[model samples]
Target chain A: MDFSLTDDQRMMQESLSRTLAEASSLDRVRKFAADPADRGADVWAALTDFGLPGIVIGEEYGGLGLTLLDAALMAEALGRAVTPVPYLGAVLAPLALRLAGSVEQQARWLPKLASGQVTAAVAISEAVAGARDGAGLMASDGKLSGKALFVADGHAADLLIVADTGGVLHLVDGTANGLGREIMTGIDLTRRMAELTFDKVAAEPLTGDAGALARLRDAGWVLLAADTLGACDVMIEKAVAYAKERKQFGRVIGSFQAVKHLCAEMAAELEPCRSLVWYAGYAFDAAPQESSLVAAHAKAHLSEVSRFIARTATEVHGGMGITDLLGLHFWFKRVGLNRQLLGGPERVRALAAQMQGLTG
Target chain B: MDLRLSPDMEAFRDQVRGFLGQHKDRYASGAGAERPREAAMEWQALLIDNGYAARTIPKAYGGYGAEPDILKSRIIAEEFTAAGAPRGFANQGISMLVPTLLEVGSEEQKIRWISPTLRGETVWCQGYSEPGAGSDLANLQTKGVEDGEDFLISGQKIWTSTAAQADMIFCLVRTEPQAPKHDGISYILFPMTTPGIEVRPLKTMTGSAEFNEVFFTDVRVPQSAVVGGRGRGWFVANATLKHERGMLGDPNATEARFAALIDLMKSETVDGQRLIDNPVMADRLMQLQARVMTMKFNGLRTLTASITGEAAGLAGMVVKLQGCELNHQIAALAIDALGELGVLYEDGPHLRAKGGWQRNYMFDLGLIIGGGTAQIQKNIISERGLGMPREPKLAVA
Candidate 1:
């Protein structure tokens, strides 16, 4: 069977990687983290030019009708560079909509999203942890209430793909009446999070079934898994290179067996993390039945593995791994933020076990 | 890029699966097909008869001549592994020697060896690790001195799996003593029945004599027996190792083993609660399943890398290590979760699932040690995969 990437997809990945490497390197990420409000409009426009936002939108929506795999490639690149764009919120949210959204909803919002003119965030997480079934948010009488905490790119978005108590998806304007936002200080600075308070705000349903909210949550989890996989790679590479260059005990610390073992563990964990992302990505694109389990596995594994890599990487760098000068912490923060985002490793692991039919 | 398989390939996978389904009753057995080598040999011959052996070999070399598709190969491996096929027996011959031959064997070599090896007419074992050269394989002292048309070899090789059963061997010997450690090595192929060869089986924790200590007292083989160039055996061996590690991605095989363990846990109660229902056991099984799935996915990523010809050095060194570690973990978890019943062997009256988990727990040490020690894999990734500096070798005065 042919598992190879098409030439266009390969070039897309290469150009995207090159752009991120040149314009939004770890150094650039560190700079952006210092000023989160300073959006990368030029870079975002470059991404639009690169068709990053339009890769998955249908041609009828003024975008390329690319598969989920294409979006995955871009997500991975963004993850590796720790690029501070709401690409996931902007791209993945729409892609999920196209997959599970209503026909009219697709007709209404797809073009604006495909043109990169609007950014959106999916509000699935509630005020408290482990609230799986639209825990705190309630939607009734064409009015939405309750709050969604840690709404990614919440403050910067033009729209919110809101999931209510009944699990229907609603496309709500960011400035809907009674909606308030409290910018939350998070471990990751490049990506902003906010506590969104919806005080009976006007809402519109995007998906009729509440079950689609689960799909949205699952898709979002897998995307984060993809992103964490990328961040893990960045941290691993940075730590390894740093170890090779930084000297201690009259020799490169890398030459020491202890350091060797440490980096090897990272490599070990990183490899599996990569595989999980791919399988989850493949499942997301191809197999629906296995996607939830695979996604949970990828997310849980990446959550733990990326954090382990970051921790080990920082240790390998000694004092410098923690500092902004090294820029390794950016990846570390990204991994941490991703880990805590939808459901932490504990939640995902529990879900994975249930999916595997191993629940007690 | 199209990650989807072509329709023909999909049909081919189905054909392979259909064939496996028809013949799975024959291959179904426990993991302990390690020694008494006849069972493995017979199984290998059956695979050859069915054209399921040496799957990656091209048609001219007595293989299916299928295109290099890692996913297809992965599916075949997973199906066969699920059927409890003897995977260890094929490790050296199918996984290592056959692939290396495809990469570097001469036309004469391919015609002479590849077909027979794939046909199971010639069983093979690897002779790489020695007592003193476990992780540092290049430090092996096995030497072959040239004498006219042949090379006289005299050395000792330890930890050679299937040595007693192997009819042929693909070994590395020191051909240039004065050269650097890596440079002096040569990969050689020879009949195990050659003069001066002795295979002494060594019993392990599994209570099986599966491995051997082979000694060669001036063994002679023709110059043409070398797989690649002389003094380049290190590279050939490395190539073989790479192939061996790549094919080790079927993590779902553990599913069956875990199934067997769960069955035992169902019948046997622990603390008045079913063992499978225990929170600790449940948590451990769940974690193991997650890790297994993670490893499976990692394998897919590496397969993608292999299919695309991207660099997979990191992928190879890491996934297998993780697999081995997970295997060990699952085995231990099975034992602990079994309570007192976990310690019994197959023949015991209190035997549970044929004492498979106990045997597997003991046998898994070899998996970590055979291809490369977990420590060595870590070192490789740290140094090569991660661009870390190499660890200094102990000074040889």
Candidate 2:
């Protein structure tokens, strides 16, 4: 009857957090964000050393074989540092493969993906859910065509797992003959997105049914929620630290009830979200019957609450919050992008309503 | 991360279900309606005797005397709530004062107070908040001047719920005039019917007089009535306040209310369509569902932390603030779903759910303010939980 992280889970988070703190500092993140070619190679190497990319890959495939909860923890650490590395893809690609891939397919890519020899990105927008600009992909006759937009960490991947219009997942080589990839400048530079065009590119369909795709979507929601939780935590800490040192009217602004309440409100609203994300992640593994609904709830609720925390935490900083030099915008924009990445709060809530049989 | 109950705990749940099944008719008759006091007391005593209530208190104090097991306690609460059975008495006496007595009371005080409170033989009202000392409770000027072996208490306490019906009151009073505000106080207990005591019912927005303005004018009680010693009332009251906050923000109550809201949405119709079927209403319901689920999981996390002896920190601190606000939002949404029917009060012919939603909407507002205003809770969360600087003290003129 426990609903908390195991000691080993806590240690894993701490180790990853320590590694990110050293390897993905704000300067390093800025450097990566500013450079079009860097692609956070150094940060990815750090994560590889920490064995993060394979946290959820099957042990038989030369990977760690951990649960979605472990992967969610890694996502949280990445979000906390706002590290400019390709983690969302690193986690989700393996998850989709494991959930839907054939044994042969798993054996082919799992080891490379685990060892960071190959990086993968997922293109599910307009497939399992709606995309902002009606972006989509189509598959036929062992070939993929059409465009997939908002592909997270897509520009520099060695492999691409694209979901078709019918919610079928297909694996495509990044360097396929007819494939084209273009970077899409997004608000969050910590994690990049891309637009992929597939023109008769050869692809292999995952053997499993749509249930795997749905499970993969649920995992995505939980991971996004976990990431939002970590981002909110850092934003609140940054705001509190700033308020403690920033003086106004002859005293630390933190001593003012207004500033204190702002910090307090952020903490209050975000604290419970930790449990929500944890439960959603736990449900993904242990309570499959409830996973989809809980994941939707976590995603929608955190999307709303994280916006409040982000905006309010920034407001707590007054003018410095808007300045690029303060770098609060990194977290601010990270949360902004997370809010809309898979599905914003409204879309997610609508899906949850449908799942509950409340919508026609 | 495991949420599965152990086989032993599962067996215990079956035992509870079996017991409730046998006595189901005894309490089920008045499931949602208010029961007669005598019948309620009988039901409470049966529960205490069966180790369902007061499960951890010693038998000498007329309790079940079981070891404290959080999972078992949660199981009992869940089964009892599910069965529509009254899970013994809950009030200022039982939830707040009893725990304080168990922690810091004299043996005599415990023996005299714990059993009756547990058995619903006595009801208590808290006398802590004053007109000038609400958020600043330490500024209370309720004086208890010593006269021989008794103290003559004089003060006014507002927002005292159930004061008009209470058998006794656990009160805070300043006993040392020269000492600092927080250090000069004492916590004392006395009969509500003591001399010079007056209770004026304070009708709230819910159109009921559940609370009162309790006036203590030269009320005399033995000095021995003081619990946890003199000059320690602040600390004792703080302990009881913790219990009070917990009582007000019960996740079980919120869950039950949310369930009722869903039922109402299903049953009520607008424009000949079920409220639950409306797109806008459904969206709102799902949003609230998300928050409600958060409260449930957060409660589990807190319970796990308690069992594992880990510091819950901010998670524990935000419950009252979040729970109260979420409950109020649920009730508000219920009323909104009712449409024009929402405006109907208890006396209205078309009133739905016996005006429960309306009453809850108003009553939950009082709850947000009563235990501690949302602002005070935010202060506590920020200052204590987040290590933010405290609000600076104002200079004396």
Candidate 3:
């Protein structure tokens, strides 16, 4: 089994690492956050220029058809930059369509998604008053009526792919008459989310089954996990770099065991989160049967680990970490939001348990 | 990029699996010994011999393929454990002595040493930590005076595992005491049967004497016995410790413990429900299970990086640290699974897991302290892995 990234994947990582560091630096993130819509266009254009917008879309649909592993690697870079783009939504919506959408539907949407002609949002979330699982929604008579909370990048999406209680995916125009999209005040300023309330919105049902929908859900989990993994990498890097330079008690604070251990613990914890993310992304593409299992494992485990790393990293920066001056909160908050996105540790563990036949 | 094995590797795994399948007799006795201790040793030998062609020399040896592929190493480990091989080949002779010899020993020494150790014929114990030097091992007071073509050594080494059973001891001694503590040392190998050498077993808190304190009162050895140069023992000893860290407290040990815990929980019931059916217990198991899975992937990632000539990054430093922590948690969870019965050390109806939890809970204490304490691990991770500056030394009063 090859666990190393392919050469192209490495190139994608390096390219994005360089591009994001320059284009979406902390200052850039703050600027983008001021007007998320403007940020969305700029981020989308850069990603499209790098051909990342279509990284996962099939070549036949004027896209790259790269594995989710590659896109997930890019997602990590996005996370590192806290880049304000609807990557999870844009990539996953196309992925859902690829896995479940009809030929006509994919033909219409995949190309635009690849070329940045349109943005998409994934509505796999449940209502605020319901279970975190997407089973809270139901579509009746080709008109969808349910609340999809935490709809990522919902405000910027030209299209929305919403899932129902039966695991059927329904495509709806973002500007549909009955669709109500409310922007969410999320913890991470670097990204955006929304609550989409569907009131008998005209929906085009995708030709997919429960199984396909599960794969799509797992793909989302893997992608989100990759994002957190990226954020974690950045947190430790920032923490270590800060520790080395920040002096106190007549020596660099890194020389102090207390601060040293914090950075060390974070490094050790994140090392595993990375491996989990890679496998989760790879499993989605190469090992479909075990995709959900690894995805659940990655999402749940990274969610827990990334949070620890984030906080410990912030702790490493001392008072400066919690302050807006260092802006380390961008990554810390990004990790916090990623942990709760899709589902948190306990919920994902339950999904993993079902996969293992340990619980019904 | 992928985790699926190639057809060739799969075929190799199938062959290994077949050999393991044939010998399904359990090794570790739970109050009842299923196989002789000799049989268990032989089973380990069989595993080493059986996976010979599949075994790749470690990356340190510049041999990378087939076996050094972490997946292959893991598969071999899986089959060996499935066949009930020992938790690990914790033999200092193989894990530490052989690697050190291969790195710095003379051609004659390697030819004379590595094979016999791998065959379990010549047991060896490390003689690095002395009574005066525990964590700051460089300060060891063990000294060897030059005596034409040999060295007369007189000092004591403590916390030596398997010294009583060892045929030979790989030691560090101060050959040039006037030099700096680190530079004045030498790595030497000598037979445990040498006159004036003594081994006293030290019973640990676990109620077992798996560790020993060894004394060398003017023990003599030929000059050829020194592996690394006389003034370079510190660096050589570091190499052995690196090897030691890689083997001791491996995640595989915890994985085995986890599997055993699950089996016990399956066989056990409380109020007509399986112990694992309890929400609190199940959630804890799931968490441990997730940690174990992450460890597995981390191992693969490290292996993949090693084979690809990429710096393994923090994954290398993570294994032993996380392994000790994970095992402690796993052991704790096992005790939690037993509830009030966990306090029972010996056999009884309420003594779930055949009282293994109590035994493990104590045994695990030594593991976390043995190779390096958790604090020491964190220090290494911080200093080496995170590039943190070393902590200032305290002044001796």
Strongest candidate by lDDT: 2
For candidate 1, the docking band is acceptable
Give model 1's DockQ, 2 decimals.
Answer: 0.46
Q: What does the lDDT come to for candidate 2?
A: 0.88
Candidate 3 segments exceeding 4 Å error: A36-39, A127-136, B18-75, B85-90, B111-115, B147-150, B222-224, B394-397
Deviation in Å, model 2, residue B50 alpha carbon:
0.9
- Order of candidates by lDDT, top first? 2, 3, 1
What's the DockQ of model 2?
0.86
A66 Cα displacement, candidate 1 (Å)? 3.0
Cα lDDT tens digits for candidate 3, B189-293:
999999999889889766778678998899988878988777899999888788788875576777788888888677677798988888778778888888888
lDDT: worst 10-residue window of model 3 chain A? A127-136
Q: What fraction of the true interface does each of the listed models get right, in terms of native contacts kept?
A: 0.74, 0.89, 0.76
| A79-161 per-residue lDDT for model 3 (tens digits) | 88889887887788888788778889989899998887888888876521135444356689999987887888887789898
What TM-score should be assigned to candidate 1?
Answer: 0.85
Clashing pairs in 2: none
| Regions of model 2 farther than 4 Å from truth | A131-134, B28-36
lDDT of 2 by residue, B375-397 (tens): 99999998899898888788988
- Measured against the true two-chain complex, the DockQ scores of the candidates, in the order shown, are 0.46, 0.86, 0.62
What lDDT tens digits, residue by residue, belong to model 1 across residues B190-230?
A: 99999999999989988888789999999999988998899
- TM-score for the B chain of model 1: 0.87
Candidate 2 is graded, for docking, as: high
